[model samples]
Target chain A: MEILLAIVIGAAFGAVLDRIGASNPTVIGKMLNLTSLKLMKTILLAIGTGSILMFGGQMLGLVDVGHMSVKTAYVGVFIGGLLLGAGWAVAGFCPGTGLVAAASGRKDALFFIAGGLLGAAAYMASFPWVESTGALQGVLGGKVTIGAVPGSGYDGLFSALPGDIAGLVMGAAFVVIAFALPERLNPRGERLARAH
Target chain B: MTLSWKSGGVLLGVVFFLAVLLVKPIGVSTQFVIFDGILWNAVDSAVVTQTAEGVTSSNAYLAKSDGKYAKAVANPLNYSFVFVIAMMLGAAVSVWARGGLDRAERTMPALWRANFGDGAGKRYLAAFIGGFVVLYGARLAGGCTSGHMMSGMMQTSISGYIFALGAFAAAIPTAMMLYKEG
Candidate 1:
């Protein structure tokens, strides 16, 4: 039953990703380069809205706090994120988007998938040495939330502000920013047209 | 056939919210590791061994979490794995529904062509290298954009915010340096 549900959920997620142009590398590249802001706006809005719905659902008792998974805080996570960002700019596809692109019949995505699998293999092979380096060691209380929530196993960084409320406020901010962003920061096409 | 980005974004948000509220958060990077483990286990029977306790892997990473990953390796039909496969299928379905790839999609994107030219091989190589770097970093970070940035921020995890910061900090500059034409 759960597996069937997974397919439904995953398919919906992928379809939306494709509809929003995330399956296209040029769209991603444009977002990162500020040549186009459509994808970025969409992403910000999605994240903001999702955060609001999730935190709001939790507050309304429609969502289970236990189901909320908090990844451990570690130095490696931040460092690795930096590395991932560089790669994202270069390749213009994250794992999910890469898969979506491949399925969308973008041939380059196949190469990306192959590369990703090889990369995962490399990580598995070096897991021991990486672990020994202490980069993966938990930091900042291992798993924690920005603000405390009742029944959540994770600790809170700020006790005064409820985590759900914090999420809601931040989500709203994201939505506002998403709406405010211009469609294009570069407008190179328009500029070139004007020049001609 | 494509929805506007705004509508798509709302739909995506709703889907993500429902996934978390009803089941679990959406994640995809871990599956890459699982895929590797599965293939390795097939090649070398000793890579993963099932015992009375549970499935165990000779690989330390897979062996951690009480062999939870090893168990997934042995039984590859878990929710997460299936979800990833479904995502691919969904993407393919979307393309087919849209009447297949149009000329623009079949070739290089305008922005990419403006900066990098229309060499499919270059794009493929770049995509592959980029994917390699991203996945390698994801494993090191213990998550990807979906798991850590999107899901974590939704739940208000501090690590998620930190990861997002690091990602954007590097991504913006790299994009600037790489694509001046765009």
Candidate 2:
């Protein structure tokens, strides 16, 4: 039953990814290069709105804080993020969007997926050696939130600003930026138009 | 109406909210780890058992009761795996509906071609290397862009914000250096 629901949700999510031109490497590259803000605007709006719904629901006691899965802060995560960013810029696809791109029949995406799976497998295989290196150590295990809520198993980043208020402010800021950002067509698009 | 970036973003946000409301946070990186577990389980159940018990180098974190890896190993048809497969199905369906099937090809885009040249072998090699590095980093960090950045930021986790900052800090510079203006 849960799996079925997941499928439906995943399908909708995939469709949204595709519709936003996330399946196109050209679009992704342009966004990364700051040549266009279309994808960035969409991403900001999505994150902002999601933040409001989640934190807002928690504040109202309508959502169970226990249901949320929060990750720990660690030095490894920060460093890994740098590597992931580099990979994303070079490959033009993240893990999730790569799957969607492959599904959309992009052969390059299939290669990317293959590479990702192999990479994951390699990581697993080398787990023993890697774990011993202490690279994955130094974790701050407790949950950290921007504001406080009763029975929430997390710490607030700021004592003065409540989590809900902070979330609301950030969410609203993103929405405003999304609205203000103007989309520019990439040079590739202009070149294609000229050819046509 | 056809989906635009703005509307699509709104819809994605709503779907993400619904996902959190109905189940848990949405992420795709851990699904790969689960796949790794399944593969190990197939080759040698003992290795998986050892790994789960922290007897091996493989991380025991995912084998926790609430972990996605645990769910996947318990049942190959788990929620994360199904979600990923459905993502592909949804994309295929959308492409078919839009008559884009015929347009699908194994080729690099103009931007990539302009920068990296039009060699299929070289493109695939780059793709493969990039994919490997990204997944490796995601596993090491215990999350990917979706898991750490999107889902994390929504929940107001400081790590999420930091990860996003780090990602953009590296990604923007890398893109600027690699990007060739056409």
Best model per lDDT:
1
Kindly list the per-residue Cα lDDT of model 1 for residues A57-98, writing each as its tens digit: 888998898888999989989998998898888888898988
lDDT of candidate model 2 versus the reference: 0.77
Q: State which docking tier applies to candidate 1.
A: medium
B2-80 per-residue lDDT for model 1 (tens digits): 6776787788889889889778999999999999888888889899998899899888989999998999999999999
- Can you write out model 2's per-residue Cα lDDT over B1-182, one digit (the tens) per residue? 23676887788788788788888888898787777777766776654444454333234555444444655665778777898889889977887788774342447766788777778888888788888988887877778878888888877777787678878888888987888564
Residue A97 displacement in candidate 2 (angstroms): 0.6
Candidate 1's displacement at residue B53, Å, is 1.6
DockQ, all candidates in order = 0.75, 0.64
For each candidate in turn, give its C-alpha RMSD to the true structure in angstroms: 1.8, 3.3
Tell me how much of the true interface, by contacts, candidate 2 captures.
Answer: 0.70
For model 1 chain A, the run of ten residues with the poorest summed lDDT:
A187-196
Q: Per-residue lDDT tens digits of candidate 2, residues A76-179?
A: 77877888899889998889988888888777887888888887877766766767887666455446777654466677767566767787788888788888
